[model samples]
Each structure stands twice: as C-alpha cells, then as structure tokens.
Target chain A: MSDYILHCFAQSGNAYKAALMLELSGADWKPEWVDFFNGATRQEGFREGVNEMGEIPVLVHGDLRLSQSGVILDYLVETLGTFGWETEAERREILRWILFDNHKLTGYTATLRFLRFIAKTGETDVVKWLETRATAAYAILNKHLDGREFVVGNKPTIADLSLCGYLYWPDEIGIDLSPYTNITRWLETLKALPGWQHPYDLMPGHPLPCA
Target chain B: MSDYILHCFAQSGNAYKAALMLELSGADWKPEWVDFFNGATRQEGFREGVNEMGEIPVLVHGDLRLSQSGVILDYLVETLGTFGWETEAERREILRWILFDNHKLTGYTATLRFLRFIAKTGETDVVKWLETRATAAYAILNKHLDGREFVVGNKPTIADLSLCGYLYWPDEIGIDLSPYTNITRWLETLKALPGWQHPYDLMPGHPLPCA
Candidate 1:
C-alpha cells in the first residue's frame, strides 16, 4: 500500500511542490488529483480531506492529514531523506527561499495570473497593481540570481523547486521571462529534471503557457 | 563557545520565535539586539549580516548566515532536536501555521496595528479591509481551537508560538480581543509559559507586564 496520498489539482504550483518532493524522495505515494477549476477543493468531501481551512496540496498519510506545500516538502524531506538539501545549513536557505516565494512572489504573480488569464480582467487598477508587484518581485529574483545558478548556494534544493513551480506560470500569462535570464536558465535546468511537468499539463485544455 | 548568534530587535515576534527555540534547546547562543526604531535593520552592517536580503531574525553560526524567521525556526528544530514540535507530523503542522500567519494574519494585524497606533493614518479603506481579514483569520483560529488548547494538537507547538506571537499584538493596536474568547484564553495560557516576554518590554518606555 502506498504510504501517502497527495490530494491536489494536478497543475497547481503548490501541488507540484508536493509532487516534486515525492519524486525526489522516491516515496511510495499516489496522487489523488482534485479538479480545482471545477471547485473540487470547495467540496465538502474534499474539505473533510483537509483541515477546516480549505487549501490545496493536502497530504493524507494514514490518519494524519498535512496541509501547506512548504510543510509537506519539509515533512517528505525529513521522513524520506532521499535528497541532499536535507542538511542543516542548506535546509535553512531552502526554507528562506520557500518563505520568500510565498511572501513576496506568490502574492503578486498569482494575482496577475488570475486576473490576466482566469479572471479575464484586463488592465484594471488591481491588475496593474498586481503587475507592479510582479515586476518588483521579478527584479528582486533577477538581482538575487546575478552570479548564482540556483537560488541558495550551489546545489539544487527545495528553494529552486518552489520557485520553479511558481515561475512556470509566467509564460502562460504573457509575462516576458527574457529579462530574467538567470531565472530563464534556471527554469530550463529544472525542466530537464525527471518527472518535471508544465503547470498547464495537469489541467486539460487550459492553453499551455497560459497566453 | 556558542554555536550561533541571533540578531533581532528585542521584542519582535519574529525574533522571539527564534530565541524561544534556542532557549528551549539549551543551545549556546548570544543575542545581538537591533534597534528597529533607529533604523538599525536598514544599515549596511545589518544588511551584510543577512546576505543581500537584509531581513531578520538573522542567525549566524561559524561561516553560515541565515535569515527569515520560518527558516531560522526550522533550522533550530532540525539541528538542535530540542523541541518536541520538530517531529515529522508536528513539523508539517508547524510550518502550515507559520505560513498561515505570515500570509494571512501578519499582513492584516500588522496593518491594523500600524494604523491604530504607529502610523495613525486613519485610512478607513485600509483599516476596514484589515478588520475584515483579521476577523476571517480569527474565525479560523477560533474554530481550530474549539476544544484543543494549542494550535496544532494538545501540546504547545511552534504553530502556537507563531500564531500567539502575532495575535498578542492585536491588543496593542486596540483590537478588541473580547470577541475571540478562545483566542484570548489560549493567549493567556501561552503568556504564562517560561521565557515568555511581552513585546513592550523590549521597548524603551513602555510599562512591562507584571509577571
């Protein structure tokens, strides 16, 4: 029997985070994919699968249910111990970038992605504000990546995975990625990894690359 | 010799989270208090203390320098093995609650506190929006704390620390804690813990809470 079941929408960045970790860890698990576009997350049955707060990337391990992508990643890393980023110092950097993505990047990019693609709302004040936040966020990333290959020191860690999953949506939203050459190069490197899937691939007929 | 030095503003919630873990772990460490009111964090010296990101609480151990509160907390738990919350199951829950606080509670409560006390901007739209967010966050907490004494399970975990640290600030901002009786009760319980320090105690002139 699989040790755990990942409940998430296939294309979600958060879901992909769990998937990435599971694949990296080589853990025995099955993906119980949920249709987030169709409000599967809001369903009462699915709600029961998670905590009272309805959020994605919920990992159900026997009787224990875990929510939040960062938490799930940490859990898999700790339990499975398959990856090199599990070291003490490296783990701190990994977490720093993960929290950074959640605090700074996700706030704006997700908003812009929704407005431009899902919401179909064009050029409104909110959209502009999101765009500005996205721009600032990208600039910060661009500066951080100036001489570095990966986000942290040298090796590919959970930091890279979390960032790659979130940044994968840029092309879909017609946000130019060329300006961030380091990020672009990093994404290419990330895609080369085994079990890598574009965000839209998990969603049927959602127009690959979002644009 | 101490393994690390934690640099933080005396009474910051973020800083306290790191210190609490260190103290609980019995880790050898020294505290370098930064004066936030005097813009110590913005100085080049502090920026160098935390890489280019320039945020705290920053942890320095030998050649390693780490920033971001969540990252620091994880590092302490992973490395020291002193806190019970470091367990696989509890760790994930801890991360979830920390992220929940960062993404949801901190923004709203911080803004509310700033408006009510620090800035006194009287921006009704911002205050109203913050109040709404705070209410939603509190409702989630109240439900989660229905019968449990702590945020995660029965015992006090890092989740409780992260949530309680932020929640304790609401009263300073004139937020009526009376409505969330459960949260208030839980806060009282947490405040009575050993090494618990009121944020105001770190400030120059504010009256310290009678222990």
Candidate 2:
C-alpha cells in the first residue's frame, strides 16, 4: 500500500493537480484509477463510500480521506514539505491564485475542453460562451505572469501547480496559445520542473477505452 | 476610516461573501462600491491597479490589498480570530468546503444569476447549459448539508459564507431551491445568526443606476 492513494482518471486535470503534486514531492503515492467516464462518480455507491462531493482526486492518507485538489495540494505542502508558502502573507497570496484558478481558469478552460474534446459537443453556444470566458481568464493570467516566473514568490508553489494543471492540455481545449506569450512562458517554466509529467502519462484511462 | 475597506458592489455575491463575513465577525468595515454594472472591472486600469484578476470584493486593510473571497475570509479568520479552525484537520476541512464552494457552488450559481437576472439573455442555449450545471452543483451541496447546521464544525465558518454567497439569490438564479430541503434549512439557520444581513443590504450599489 502506498502512503497516499489518489482516486483519479487521466482526463481530469483537477485530479492531475493532485497526482502531479504527489509525484513532484516524491511522495509514496499511487493513482487508484477512477472510471469517471463510465459514470462511476455519478453512482450512489461512489458518492456514499468515496467523496460525498461526487468528484475524483480523492487522496487517502491512512484514515484521512480528502477531496478537492486545492486541499490536497495544501496538505501535501505540509506533510511533504515541498512547494509551500513560508509566511502567512505568501500563503494567502498562493491561495488567491488557487481560488482564481479554480473559479476562473480551470473553471472555464476545463469545461470548454470537456465539451469540445471529451463530450464531443462540437461548437455549440455553450462551448463558444465558455471560450470567451476562458480566454479572458487566460488574458488576465498572462498579464499577471509578465515579469514573474511563477504564480507567487520566486519558487514554484502549489499555485503554479494548480494553474498549470489544465494549460498543458491546450490541444484538447482547442485554444490558440500563441497570443498569451507570458502564460506560454510560464507553462514552459513549469514543464521544466523536475519530475513533471503530462497528465496522460501520470494517470490512467487516457485515450479512453473507446478510443 | 473603517478598519477594513471592501471594494464591492451589491449585485456581486462574490463580494457579498466577504461583506457578510466582515459583518458577522463585527469587524469595522465599509464598502467602497465598484461600478461593476458599468464596465468598471473590465477596464484595463482597474484590472492593472486594483486587482489583476479583474474582479471586485477586494479587501484593503492598511498596507494589504487582498482579492478572492476565500483569501479574504481566511485573512479575516486570522485577523478577527472568529469562525476559524483550532486544529489542522479542522482547517483543512474548512478549506475543502470553501474550495468546493468556489469551484462548484458559487461558480455556476453566480454565473447563472448573472446571465438570467442581470444579463437577461432570455433562456438562451448557454443559459440552459449553465442552468443544468448549476443545478447539479446545487444538488451536491444540498446533499452535503444534510443533518448539518453548518458547512464545517457545528458553528459557521468561511465555508458557509462562501457557499451561501449566491444561494440567497435563488429568484435571480431562476432555480426552485425548495426541493433542496437541507440547504433551505441550513440557510434559515445561518439567517438566525447574529449580524446576518442580505448582500443587497450589506453592500452598496444594490439598485443599479440602470435598474
């Protein structure tokens, strides 16, 4: 048994946030491979037995079962002592970006990707609507990254990890990354981190069984 | 001068989260209304100067200017020392819910309300799409509130503040939340708390100039 077990599927960038964190920290963690596409998360048993939130990337460390990538990343920072804030101010700053990532970045980008690639919804009204919002979020982040190497502080923290989770999947998201020069640089910088792996390589169920 | 100044407008439930928190904590805070309805946040100057993320609910306490309601709530927990966790586990638990609130609950609900009530898109395809996603998010939250007085612990915390931000505007969201019995009960319980006030009342710019 690994020290930490992450219930995750490959396509989920949210789960990749945790999976990548565990890997980078060199923690003894393993991916449990959730069958999200098969409607596993939608089932009652998964809801009752696993995360009541009905989501993946549930990290189980001993008796503690935790969901939410932000929580898991923060927990890993403390337990593993890697990619964390040194002071309360930095911690708050890091959290600000993480909240922004969840609310704005991944919030729209992930949905656009899901609709366009995974769900194959095509260029529907919702997909186009999501694209505009996602692009706006990207523009804000690109401007924020103008002179900074990471989201917060000089070192790479979980903020960088969380924000970069879905950016690496731009192909699936069907977005033009050329316009966002700073964000492109930041994503490349994150990719240069030691032990970093693509979401598909880090978890299971990629290319889908149907694919 | 107030101890804390919240850069907010009444219609923004995101800003209201911090406003309500400041109120409940009995912190000396005043709202410096942002003309969000009139393209204030979208302005480049506001984005570059106030918050690069380009959103309101910015909290200013002397030297510090903080954005993101979760960050503000956590900062208040430190400064005010109320509605905060005593243990690491409790703190993580609170953060879990807050993240869920930002990513799921308030994310969809707030957008739905913005499109329906404020934007008044007239039940467009995107509106229907957001409605579906918003309802799913609500269902998950409604179930989580079962048999619980608050989001974390028995007492109210920032998690409740963040989740309840948009839930109070059910009419604007065009969702019949009555079916979510636990959530309805939880809101009632929260309303019974001392210093509880509606977002429209707690912040300025309630009745928009156009409205």
Candidate 3:
C-alpha cells in the first residue's frame, strides 16, 4: 500500500495543492478518485467518513485521515522534510501567504473558474463580482512577487504551492495572465521546479463530459 | 510601550480575531485603529508601510510586522504559549480548521457582512449569492461544532478564535443564529472566556458616524 492516499478529483485546484505536494515530495502516494462532479462529497456517508467540511484533497496515512491542503502540506513538511520553513519566522511568513491564498486568491479565482468554465454559468453579477475580487487579489500577489522568486523565501515553500494552486488554469479562469506580469513570472519559476505537473496531468476526473 | 500593537478597526472581524487573541492571552497589547472606511488600507502609503495585502489586522512586535490573522494567531501561540497543540497531529488539526475558516467560513461571511452592514448594498444578486455561500459555511461550522466545545481540539485554539471571528455579529449579517444551536452555544462558550470582549469593545472604529 502507498504511504499516502489522497481523496481527490482532477479539476479541484485545492486537491491539486495536496496532490502536487505529494508527487513533488517523491512520497509513496496514490490518488483515490472522488466523484466530486457527481456530488459525491455531498453524500452523507462521504461526510461522515471523509472531510466534515465537504471539501476534498484529504490525505490518509495508516490510521490517520487529514483534510485541508494547508494541513496536509504542513504535515508533509515534517514527514518529507521538503518545501518547509527552517524557522518559526519562516513558518509564519509561509503561513501568511498561504492564508492569503486561501482567503483571497483561491477563494475568488476558484469560484470564478467554476462558474465560467466548469458550471458554464455565463456572465452574471456573481461572476463579475468574483472576477473583480480575484483581480484585486492577483494585483496584490503580483506586487508581492515584484522582486521575489517564491512566495515566502528564495526557495520554494508551501506558500508557493498554495498560491500557485489555481493560477495554472489561466485559460479556464478566462483572465489574461499577461496583465499580471510578476505573477506570470513567479508561476513560471514554480513550473520550472522538478516534478511539477499541471492540475490536469496530476489527478483524475479531468475533461468532464459536460464541461 | 505595549509589546504588541494591533492595527485594527472595530468593524473588522478579521482584525477582531487577532485582537481577541491578544486580549485573551493577556498580552501587553494595544489597538492601533485604522480608518478602513476612509480607504486607509487602499492608500499607497499604507500599503507600502503596513500591509501589502491592503488589509487591516497587522500585528507589530518590535521590528517585526505580521499580516493575516492566522499568521498572527500562530505567532501568539509561541509568544503566549496558550491554546497551542502539544503534538504534530494537534498542530495540523488546528491549522486545518484555520484554513477552513479563512477559505470558507470567514471568506464568505465577512464579505456578506461587509455588503449587508457596511456597504449597505441591499438585496442584489451578489448579496444573495454571498448569503447562500455564507449560510452553507455556517451550517458546516454548526455541524462541526456538534458535541464539541471547540474546533480542532476540545480546548479553545486559534481555530475557534478564527471561526468565531465574525459570528458574533449574526444580527448584522442578517443570519438567524438560533437555527445553528451548536454555533450559538460555541459562541457563548467563547464569550465566557476571560478577557473576551466584543469587537466593538476591543477595537476602534465602532459606531461609524453614519451607522
């Protein structure tokens, strides 16, 4: 059996966050495909057995099951000793960016992509609203990346793994990445990392029939 | 001088998360109010000086400045040595909930409150959409709070502090907390904690001139 089993679907950037971490860490891991597109996460059994938050990217090891990409990333840092902070200050700095990613970056971009690309909801007030917020978040990140190689430090950390989670799908997100020059450059740096794979290349359930 | 200075405004629950943690930790901290409504955070000077994220709740200690409530709360765990995990597992659990709070709980609920109470944008499609998302987050939190005194571990951790950040203003958010019995009980439990204070009481910018 693999050392880590990730309950995830391909289209989920959140899942990709954990999945990419596992793959890049070179851990013995496997992806247990989840039918998120078919509302698998909404089922009661799944809720009781898996993530209570009804989200995916759950990492299972032996008898322990952990949910949330941030949690899994933090845990892997100890077990894999890769892409982790060396000091408390670095840890907090990494966490600062990760929290920003979850709250603003992925928070807005994910929903916008779901509405525009996956759900196929045409232009609407909600979609526009999400786009505006996502744009603001992108601007902040772009400014932060002005002279930085990674989100936290000179080297790749969980912060880069977290912020760059959904940004890889620029086309699907329907937002021109060219405008955010800094973000695009920073994302390219992440792409240059070893074992880096696009979300579609990383997990299952890609190219949904309806989508 | 206070050991900690929290750049916060009373109207911001995100800021409240850090301020309340400082108060409950009994840290030598003082609130340094920011005029959020007047676009203080959006100003170039403030963005360059305080938080590049263009948000409030930046905690300053000595020469170090920290943004993001999750980061500040985690830092307090080291400085105050209270409500922190004793094990790696516990630490991940706490972080998991904190991420959930940022991504879902506070992510939707904070915007909902800002639209409904602060911006007074009434009954728009965006408002309705946010309400639905916020309500879903509330239900997930309420269900998670079932039979548990705190989020993550049984003891009050940063998870509880982060999730309960904006919940105290249910009336303002126009959500009936009575239906979420577990969340109400949990909020009361937090209110009972020593040094606990309402955001309005703990920080500045309450009772905006128009309100």
Candidate 4:
C-alpha cells in the first residue's frame, strides 16, 4: 500500500486534479478506483465512509481523509512541498483562482461534458446553456492568462491544476479550444511539466464499459 | 470614510455573502452599488478596474482589493477575527464545504434564481434543467445540515454564510424550500444571529427599477 490512496475514476476530471498533483510531486500514492458510473458515490455506505458530499477524488493519507479537490490539492502542497505558493499574498491569489475555477470553470465545463460526452444528452437547450457559461469562464481565464505563464505567480500552482482539470477534455466537453489562444498556449505550458499525465492515462475507469 | 468598501448590488447573493459577514462582524464597511442590471459588470471598464472575472462583491480595504466571495469571506475572517476556524483541521473542513457551495449549491441555485426570477425566461427546458440540478444540490446540503447547527462546526462560519447567500429568497429562486426541512431550519438558525440581514436589506439596487 502506498502512503496516499486516492479514490478516483478516469472520466472524472475533478479526481484527475489530485492525481496529477500527486504524480507530478512524486508522492507515494495509489489510485483506488471508484465505480462512479454505477452510482457508487451515491450509495449510503460510500457517503458515510468516504465523502459525505457524495463526490469523488477522496484522498486518504494515514489518519487524514480529505475530499474536495481544492482541499486535497492544498494539502498536497503542504505535504509534498511542491507546486505551491511562497508568500501569503501568492497563496490568496492561488486560492482566488481555485475558487473561481470551482465556481465557474470546472463548475460549468464538467456538467457540460457529463451531459454531452458521458450521459449523451445530445444538443439540448441545457447543454447549450452550459456551453455558453463554460465558454464565458474560458474567456475570462484566457484573458487573465494573456501575459502569464501559469494561473498564479511565476510557476505552476494548485490554481492551474484546479482550472485545467476539465479543460483537457475539450473534445468530450464539446467546446472549441482553438479560439482561446491564450488558454491553449497555457495548456501547452502545463502539459510540458515533467510527470504530467492526461486524466485517462493517469486514472482508472476510462472508456466506460457501456461506451 | 468606512474602513472597507464592498462593490455590490441588492440582487446579488454572491455580494450578499460578503455584506452579511461585514455586518455580522461589526466591520466598518460601505456598499458601493454596481448597476449589474444595466451591464455594469460586463463593461470593459468594470472588468478592467473592478474584477477581471466580471463579477460582483469586490471588497476594497486599505491597499488590498479582493474579488470572489470566498476570498473576500476568508479575508474578512482574518481581519475581523470572527466566523473563522480555530484549527487547521477545522479550516480545511470549512473550505471543503465552501468549495461544495461554490461548485454545486450556489453554482446551481444562483443561476436557477437568475433565470426563473430575475431573467423571467419562463418555464423553458433550461429552467427545468436548472431546477433539477439545483434541487439535487439542496438535497445534499439539507442532509448534511441534519443533526448539525451549522455547516462546518457547532458555530456559524463562512461556510454557513456562503451557503446561505442565495437561500433567503425562495420566491426569487422559484424552488420551494419547505421540502428541505433541514435547510430551512438551518437558515432560521443563521437568521437568528445578531446583525443578520436579508440580502435585499443588506445591499443596494434592490427591487429593480423595471420590476
């Protein structure tokens, strides 16, 4: 058993956020696959034992069991001592973007992707609405990244990790990344980071059994 | 001049989160109204100077300027020394719920309210879809509030403030809160807090001119 066990699935970009950070930092971690598609997270046992929120990417490190990718990523920064902020100001800045990402970016993109790619909801009005919101978030991020290398400060921090969670799946998300030049360029920068692995390659449960 | 200035309007629940905290903590803060209904946030000038994300509830204090309700709430806790965590563990727990609020609860409920009440888009497919998502989030929060007085711990924290931002206006949100008995009970508990005010009463631009 590894020092850290992450409950995750390949299709979950949220889970990939933590998985990528642990792998990039070279933490002694293993992936504990959660059958999310089969209503595993919704089960009473999982909610009671794992995350009460009925979400995925629960990280178990010894006595500490953490959920919510933002919290897990912050914890990894402290324990792994990499991809983190140096000053209090930088930490808050990183946190600001993380909150924005969770609230706006991943919040919309993940839902859009689930409907279009996973659930196969087709081109419904709801999907269209989600795409519009997701695109707006992408525009804000693209503009913010105009002259920056990463989401926060001069290096790759958890902010970049959190925002880029669902962005890597543009095809599945049904969004055109080509138009957002700055975002595409920034994605390239993060992709070049050593030990960076795509969500599908890094976690289990890719290519859903039904698909 | 007030020690703190918050850029907000009456109808914004996100802005209300910060306003409620400032009032509850007895912080010397003033609200600088933004004409959100008139496209103030979407304007280039507002985006450039106020918030790059084109959102409301930007808190300006001394030399520091903060946006994102979560960031502002966290900053206020540090400055006001109230409604915050006593330990690192408790802080992380608070953060977990806040993220859940921003990503799921407020994420869905805010938009749903905007469409159903503010925008008055009628009962379209999008509205129906949003209601489904919003109700799901409410169920999770209602269940979590069971046997607990507040969101994180026994006392009210930013987590409670953040989640309660949009819950006060059931009529505006177009979702009957009576079904979520736990959430309604929790809201009453928070309402009983000294200095607590409804979002409409706490901020400016209430009762839109056209409405």
Instruction: Name the better of 1 and 3 by TM-score.
Output: 3
- Against the true structure, whose TM-score is highest? 4
lDDT per residue, candidate 3, A1-211, as tens digits? Answer: 9999999988999989988888888989999999998899999999988978899888999999999888888888888999999888898889889889999999999999999998888999999999999999999999999998888878999889988899999999999999899999988988888899998989988778777
lDDT agreement of model 4 with the native = 0.93
Clashing pairs in 1: A172-A209, A172-A210, A172-A211
TM-score of model 3 vs. true structure: 0.98
Compared with the true structure, what per-residue lDDT tens digits does model 4 show for residues B18-116? 999999999999999999999999999999998999998899999999999999999898999999999999999999999999998898899889988
Best by lDDT: 4
Give the CA lDDT, 0 to 100, for residue B144 in model 2.
82
Of the true contacts between chains A and B, what fraction does model 1 have?
Answer: 0.59
Residue pairs in clash, model 4: B10-B204
Off by over 4 Å in 2: none
lDDT of 1 by residue, A15-114 (tens): 7777777775677887776667777766777656465666778888878788877777777766776444745567666778888787667655765686
**Which lDDT values do the candidates have, in the order given?**
0.70, 0.91, 0.91, 0.93
* Tens digits of per-residue lDDT for model 4, A101-203: 9989999999899989989989999999998999999999999999999988899999999999998888999888999999999999999999999999999
In the range B1-211, model 2's lDDT, one tens digit per residue, is 9999999999998999999999998999999989888889889899878998888889999999999999999999999998898789999999998988888888888888888898888999988988898888889888888888888888888888888998898888999999999999999998999999998899988787665
Model 4 lDDT, residue B54, Cα = 97
